[model samples]
Target: MTATAVQRFYRYHAYVYDFTRWTILRGRGQAVEQLKLRPDAQVLEVGCGTGLNFSQLLARLDPRRGWLTGLDFSEDMLARARRRVAAHGWSNVSLVCADAARMDLGRRFDGILFAYSLTMIPDWLAALERARTHLEPGGRMVVLDFGRFERWGPLGALARGWLRLNHVETRRPYVETMGSLFDRVEVHGRLGGYWFTAVGSNT
Candidate 1:
């Protein structure tokens, strides 16, 4: 989807995003925990829709000592995220409305995360490359997204079609791409291979 389409889509969905996504969007908390963020680490969350992962991230990385930046292309989504930040009193959390593929924050980060966002990106490879450039040496990058079903049966086909309707390209080789870009990469399948979590590092 183009940025405009995504924005318009979220304009309506943003209202119930947190509540609705909680059941289907799995592994986000695990992905954040896997980052193993340091107390003073600088972290970036690409496509951080509605700030769903903020609580988990803030729990792991103290706001007094660490900083978190959440970036998303949809203004509607970021609007909800802004509310989340304020409600939680996360003074150290920042939200930016911009294209993640081309965003340049004028600084690198100790850790970066993409939760259920890569498949929605048309130029996912470019976004991955850009994320690599934004990571400081030894920085970690974590991804949690839909993957091809391990068993492509009738149920798998139905699931794939349903996800496609939601603007998710489940066939994308997210793990393979991350493995190619990062020196050290670890991946784990989840939800019967319908989803996956990957952790990579720039050593």
Candidate 2:
């Protein structure tokens, strides 16, 4: 999609972005917990909309040590995120507008996260690969998103339908595909069958 189109899609939702989506998307805290960063670790969050997860990360992080960076394609979302970061005086944090599928930041990170963002991205596989490139060796990457319902039993279909209403869907081939790059890949779900989390580390 054109930058304008992506902007238009998120612009209208930027104001109520966190509230509207938080109710349904789970696994964020778990995703953050899985990062397991070291003191002074460089961390990057992809598709960081409105700084929702950033706030959580900041709260759990020691600003005196680790560094945090957030990137998104939407200007509207980044604007709100900037306000949040500034309001909290989070000097350790930085925000940028870069496409998840294409970024040349000239740096690597110890941890990378995509919290409930893969499905909404148009070229998610490329984004995953790009994230892999940004990871330091032995670095961990985490993902949380709408999940496959097949394992959710009878309610699976209904849960997927609910996600569809919000323009989100699970990427089924995520683990099988990402395994080729990351030495280890584990994908799991929660929220009564609504969301998923994947963790991977480069060999």
Candidate 3:
């Protein structure tokens, strides 16, 4: 999907994302655990729709010193995230309405995540490239997203088709792209290739 269609898709999905995504969007906790963030780490989540992953992320940081930034292209999604932050009284958290592929926040982060967000990007390679620039040296970037379902046999095709209808491209070489951009890359697939996590360490 193009950038405009992606924005439009989330404009409506933003309302129900928190209520409905638990069934399909998996591995958030495991992926966050893989990040291994420090108490004073600075965290950034690209394509952080509705801030669903913020609580898990914020829990890992030092409330007094650590900071979290949730960035998304959709204003509607960021609005929900803003409300979530306010309701939870999380002062260290901030939200940015910006394109993931072209964002320049003027500072690098200790941890960067793309939880089920990378595949939805049209220029996913550029998004990875941008995230790399935003990563601090010795930092880690973890990406958790839908995989190609290669282990599911015939059902894999059906699952990929369904995700494509929703604007997520499951067939892309996400792990390979990370290997090209990062110093060290580790990949893992879960639920028979239904989803995956790629951990890239910056050297």
Candidate 4:
């Protein structure tokens, strides 16, 4: 989908995004837990829609010392993220509006996360490459997203079609790509392989 289309798609969905996504957007908390963030770690969350992962990220990283940057292409999504940051009075969190595939923050980070975002990015490989460049040596990159269903049945077919309608392409080889880019890669399939979590290390 085009950038305009993506923005338009989230314009109104931003309001109900967190409420509805919590049920189906699984593995997010597990991904955050696997990050093993340092107290003063510098973390970047690409495609951080409405800052849904911010609270978990903050709980892991020390608020007074660590820094969390949330980046998204949709203005409407970021608006809610801004409100979340303000309402929480989180001084360490920052939000950026930019394309995940092409943004230079001018510094490397200790941890990078992509939460159910790669499927929506047409140039996901480019985004992953860029993320690798922005990771400090020995840094970790985490990915949690939809994957192929383990079962082949009507329900699986319907699920796949519904995801495609939402512009999510779950057929992409996310684990393979991460393995090729990082020194060490670990992956876990969950919900009967309907979702997956991948962790890649720059070491």
| Model number with the top TM-score | 3
Model 3 C-alpha lDDT versus the unseen true structure: 0.93
lDDT of 1 at 7: 72
TM-score of 1: 0.96
Sort by TM-score, best first: what order?
3, 4, 1, 2
Q: What would you estimate as the lDDT of candidate 4? A: 0.90
TM-score of 3: 0.98
Give the candidate order by descending lDDT.
3, 4, 1, 2
Q: Candidate 1 on 111-163: residue-level lDDT in tens?
A: 99999998888788888999889999999999999878867678888888898
Better of 1 and 3 by TM-score: 3
- Those runs of model 1 whose alpha carbons end farther than 4 Å from true positions after fitting are none
Model 2, C-alpha of 40: deviation from truth (Å): 1.0
- Where model 2 places Cα greater than 4 Å from the true spot, the runs are 1-4, 151-155
Return whichever of 2 and 4 wins on lDDT.
4
Question: What number of clashing residue pairs does each candidate have, in the order they appear?
Answer: 0, 0, 0, 0
Task: Compute the lDDT for candidate 2.
Answer: 0.82
- Clash count for candidate 4 is 0
Top model number, lDDT: 3
What digit string (tens of lDDT, one per residue) describes model 3 on residues 93-143?
A: 999999999999999999999999999999998899999999999999999
Model 3, position 123: C-alpha lDDT score: 93
lDDT, each prediction:
0.88, 0.82, 0.93, 0.90
